[model samples]
Target: MNWFWFLLFSFTSAFVLTALLRRYALCKSLIDMPNDRSSHSIPTPRGGGVAVVVTFLVALSVLLFKQLIPVDLFLSAIGAGAFVAVIGFMDDHGHIAARWRLLGHFAAAIWALCWIGGLAPISVFGEHVNLGWLGSILAAFFLVWMLNLFNFMDGIDGIASIEVITACLGACVLYALGDADHLVWPALLLASSTAGFLLWNFPQARIFMGDAGSGFLGIILGIVTLHAAWTSFMFFWGWLILLGVFIVDASLTLFRRLIRGEKVYEAHRSHAYQVASRRYRRHWPVTVVVGGINLLWLLPIAVCVTWYGLDGVIGLSLAYLPLVLLAIKYEAGQAEAG
Candidate 1:
């Protein structure tokens, strides 16, 4: 019952805050103008993701005050996520060099690792493997990559918001199925927060999430994945499966661009989702398709892994195979067609 109110509070706070932020962004001329490398044509207000960050963090702080969550989880989510969000917010206001931004991302990853006790042992092919110190390094890089990929994937209307909502809600269900009730509230709250923001971001978007919101969500989700691994390594594979769409699309595009000697940091509309949106001549279809994929395709695989003892590596491969094919079909990393 208490958790229900928390979820409601999170949703209402994010909804009202996003509305206020939209007005503020317009007044301050913080609008994202369309360009050759952009997805949207008409200029729209951005930085509305600040509402999600604020609402989620406030709810998290309250949970901490009530001792409803562990201190390490609180620090990892709040401390590291705040660092990512602050840097992202600053970058949204003015240009920040990619190098500095990457450095800050690494720093935040380290903070999260320090509090969360580094990467927990992970299951691989029915055997638990502890990577020891090497795990820490890999986890740090993983966190950085997750945050960056999220930033890259937040190109179209409501896609990023929808991804977060579905992924988090899926995770909450996994936790409940595994009887890890303590883990459900945080994930539920995150979904609720993003759901409120989606109202303003879906289809013809009235506002954008900007780097602040997307990057914060990336690191926070990564942290949640790690935290869940501490409880059950299979849950890590579940998360990896749940986030398969973004992970597969962003990673494939990035690697392909790197191989072609393209400067990956510069913005471009070559992602699978972006190309699909252009092909469909609307953003809503692509967004809706992503949501459909999450609910219908990925969620069941995640449940199988997290609750049914499916081998983590095999499960991930099963989950990613079709997505990889889809990325290729969409020309995820290819140059935009004329």
Candidate 2:
């Protein structure tokens, strides 16, 4: 079957699987209990993301088997995705220590770095940076950070799904613009699977993506963006622009928490989206606004970076400056104070 039909299959599989996972979670009494730190008030079955993971991996593996994707990239993405999904699944069912989760994240990041042959020397506005060994180390850290920040931003009902769709579609567009069709298939598949999850997850919550789901999305996005950058280092920032919504909120919130001398490891309802959700007293509108910003503010920047071969530093700043203010205005790190 062509990848296009597989897109529909992935979406249908995710939707059906999400419903099944929700039932299994409810029957098994595996639920997320709402608390001071939580964004939801009612307990909902988590780990619906397992559906997303299974469908995406299965679809991607089929492509690999068909020799449709590069062998090294296929291995790295699936291997890293599987590793992080396991840790996240374990954390969802039984609490895994943060340190252990971090270790797993780093291990997965390193595996991908090895496969990608490390970060290629990058072009930053015509200035060259040769990272060498340091490039791989930095790339590993970048992957882990993306993995964890994605988890951090998965606070509201539909925000994570929105982020996944927006970023995936944006990546697809950028890749196509570059004539880098090799990378488009995985991104498109991810968007479709997440879209399936979104049907149940959005507008109202029926089930949550748990860590398994969100972590899988995170690791895969990291790998996809890495592949983008590997193809053309200029594309590193293009991927960043495409994902600016989650990237800005999560990165700034973490920075604020760190500066405030707060324990960053503890889950808190302090992300910008969380603050907005609390303000509106609903999740969907905030999710919608985020999607709006992604399409309105970020996608164009990504297009510019892809087509013009220009440094996205300006686009990155144009995109993030407002979000930084929103984070500050929302008092993103003041969950304890609030």
Candidate 3:
């Protein structure tokens, strides 16, 4: 089968599955009710992300069977991805204590790291430096952080879906430019899967991604990033640049909340994008802007780092500077204004 067909299958499967999931959510009363920290006003069906997860994983298996993806990478994606997705699915259906969830997240991270052969040496100032076991530890924490930040950023309608689509598509282009064609399938398939879900998730969402979808995307992206790093340190930097928006906003918000002596684990709507959504009295505009930034701004920098021999660290700093300013401009991590 042509790879294009796989992409089509992924998109169609997700689209059909999302519609079915929404109906199921309605039937089961699996709804997200508005609260003080909630982004949407109306109670809506949640857990629509399960469709994306199912579509991507099934697509990944097909790719593996066709020998399009390496066995190690496939195992990593399936084992770690399914583990986190199951955890998130359970949490979405009910409650999982924060501590237990965190533990499960870490376990999943370690599982992925083991399968991916731990973190690769990174490029800094044009030099490859290995962090040894410290790098492994940091990579595990990074995976966990990515998982949680994705969940944190999924506050408003379409934002998370948009981010995943843009970021994954952006990464696909980078892989093509870098001549790492083998690395392109997973990212492209992920984007296709998310694109299908986005149809239902855009502003005035009929269904929400919920924990299962967000966490699955987070850990999967993290694993893909680490796997790409092994191919070229520049690819690692490129992926970081590609994901700058979510990383910067979520990290900055958590930092500021922690500084203010707030319980960082508690949910709040202080994220820059969340604030922007509320201020604009709409969600699509915010989501659209995010997509624009990824494609127009970040994608070029990622290309430079991956294809033009730009120093990875320098490229990362350049990519993040404006984003950091944007976060500050939106008062990211600050307390909600009364």
Inter-residue clash pairs, candidate 1: none
- In Å, residue 61's CA in model 1 sits off its true spot by 0.7
Q: TM-score of every model?
A: 0.98, 0.97, 0.98
| lDDT digits (tens) for residues 1-338 of candidate 2 | 57667889999998999989989999999888898888898888888999988898898889898877888888898899999999998898899998989999999999988887878787777787888999888888889888888889888888899998988888888888888888888888899999999988888888888888887888788888777787887678888887887887888889888998888999888888888898989988999998898888888877887787657787688878887888888877665563
Task: Please write out the lDDT profile of model 3 over residues 1-338, one tens digit for every residue.
Answer: 78787788899999999999999999999999999999889999999999999999999998899998998899999998999999999999999999999999999999898889888997888677899999999999999999999999999889888888899888988888888999998999999999999999986799999999999999999999999999998888898998999999999999999899999888899999998988999988998999999999999999998989889888899999999999999999999869
Residue 276, candidate 2: Cα error in Å is: 0.8
| Global Cα RMSD, each model | 0.9, 1.3, 0.9
lDDT of 1 by residue, 1-338 (tens): 48777888899999999999999999999999999999889999999999999999999999889888899999999998999999999999999999999999999999999999888997787677889999999999999999999999999999999999999989988999999988877888889999999999986799999999999999999999999899998888889999999999999999999999999999998899999998998999999999999999999999998888878788899989999999999999998757
Alpha-carbon deviation at 234 in model 1, angstroms: 0.5
Task: Give the poorly placed runs of model 1, Cα more than 4 Å off.
Answer: none
Scored by CA lDDT, what does every candidate get? Answer: 0.92, 0.85, 0.92
If both were scored by TM-score, which would come out higher, candidate 1 or candidate 2? 1
RMSD of 1: 0.9
**Cand. 3 TM to true fold:** 0.98
